[model samples]
Target: MDLQDQLKNLFPDHEPEESTDKIDAKPSYWLQDDPIICKYEKRKGKPITILEGYNGADSDLKKLAKDLKTFLGVGGSVKKETIIIQGDFRDKIMAFLKDNGFTVKRVGG
Candidate 1:
C-alpha cells in the first residue's frame, strides 16, 4: 500500500485539515499610487534605462528588477531604490510594468 493507504489504516476517522500554507505562499508586493519613473540616459557614452520612485520593500524591487531583466533579455542591477538596465528599452519596460499593474511615467528621451 502507498503512504496514503498506510495513513488511512493508522487513522481511519482522521479528517485532513485544509492547508493555509499554499495561500500564504502566494507572492505579494506593495502597490504604490505614484507612478514609477522610467528614464533614459547615457552613462559613460552607453545608453541605460533607469527606473526609480518605487515605495515598496527592497526585496520586491529587486524581484521586479530580476523579472524585468529576464523578460527583456538584458542586464541590470538594483542599487538601493533604483533599477539600472543596460539598454534603451524605456517603452518596452513601461509597457511591461503597466501590464503588471504599475503606473509608469516616462521621463527624458
Candidate 2:
C-alpha cells in the first residue's frame, strides 16, 4: 500500500488538521510612516545611490537592501541603516520600493 493508504489505515479516527504554517510563512517587515529618502551622490567620480531614514530593524533593512540589489542586478551594502548602491539607481529603486508598499522620497539630484 502507498504511504497515504497506510496512514489512513493506521489512523482511521484521526482527523487531518488544517495547516496554520502558511499564515506564519508570510514575509513581514516593519513599515514606517515617514518616507524613505532616496538620494544620489558622486563618490570618486562614480555615481552612487543612498537610501536612508528607515526606522526599522536592521535585519529587515538588510533584507530590503539585498532584495533591491538583486532586483537591480547591482552591488550594494548596508551601514548604520543606510543602503548604499554602487550606481545611480534612484528612480528604479524608488519605483521598486513603491511597488513593494514602501514610501520613497527623492532628495537631491
Candidate 3:
C-alpha cells in the first residue's frame, strides 16, 4: 500500500477536508489603480530603465522588481519605491507588465 492507504487505515472515519486553494491564482503583490511609469534615462552615461508610481507596500515593490529582473534576464534593484533596471527595456517591460495585469505608461524614449 501507499502512504494514502496507511493514512486512511489510521483514520477510518475521518473525512478529508476540501482544499480552498486555486491552481491558477493571481500574483499576491498588490495591484494599484494608477499606471506604473516606465521611463528610460542615461544615468552616468549608462542606459537604465526606471519603474515608479507604485502605491503598494515596499515588499510588494521589491517582489515586482525581482520578478522583472528575472523575467527579463537582467540585473535590477528596488530603491525608494522605484525599480531600476540596468538597461533600456521600456517596451519589453511594459508588455510584460500588461500581460501580468498592470497598467504601464511610457514616460520617455
- Indicate which candidate wins on lDDT: 1
lDDT of model 1, residue 83: 97
In candidate 3 the C-alpha lDDT for residue 6 amounts to 95
Model 3, 19-52: lDDT tens per residue? Answer: 9986974466688899999999998999999998
- The per-residue C-alpha lDDT of model 2 at residue 107 equals 97
Full-model lDDT for every candidate: 0.90, 0.89, 0.89
Report how far off residue 89 is in candidate 1 (Å): 0.4
- Which candidate order results from sorting by TM-score in descending order? 3, 2, 1
Report the Cα lDDT for residue 11, model 3.
98
Q: For residues 1-109, could you state the per-residue lDDT of candidate 2 as single tens digits? A: 8998899999999888988665653246688899999999999999999999999988999989888898899998998889999998888999888877789999996
Give per-residue lDDT, candidate 1, residue 8. Answer: 94
The number of clashing residue pairs in each candidate reads: 0, 0, 0
| lDDT value, residue 51 of candidate 2 | 96
Q: Which one is best on TM-score?
A: 3
- lDDT score, candidate 3: 0.89
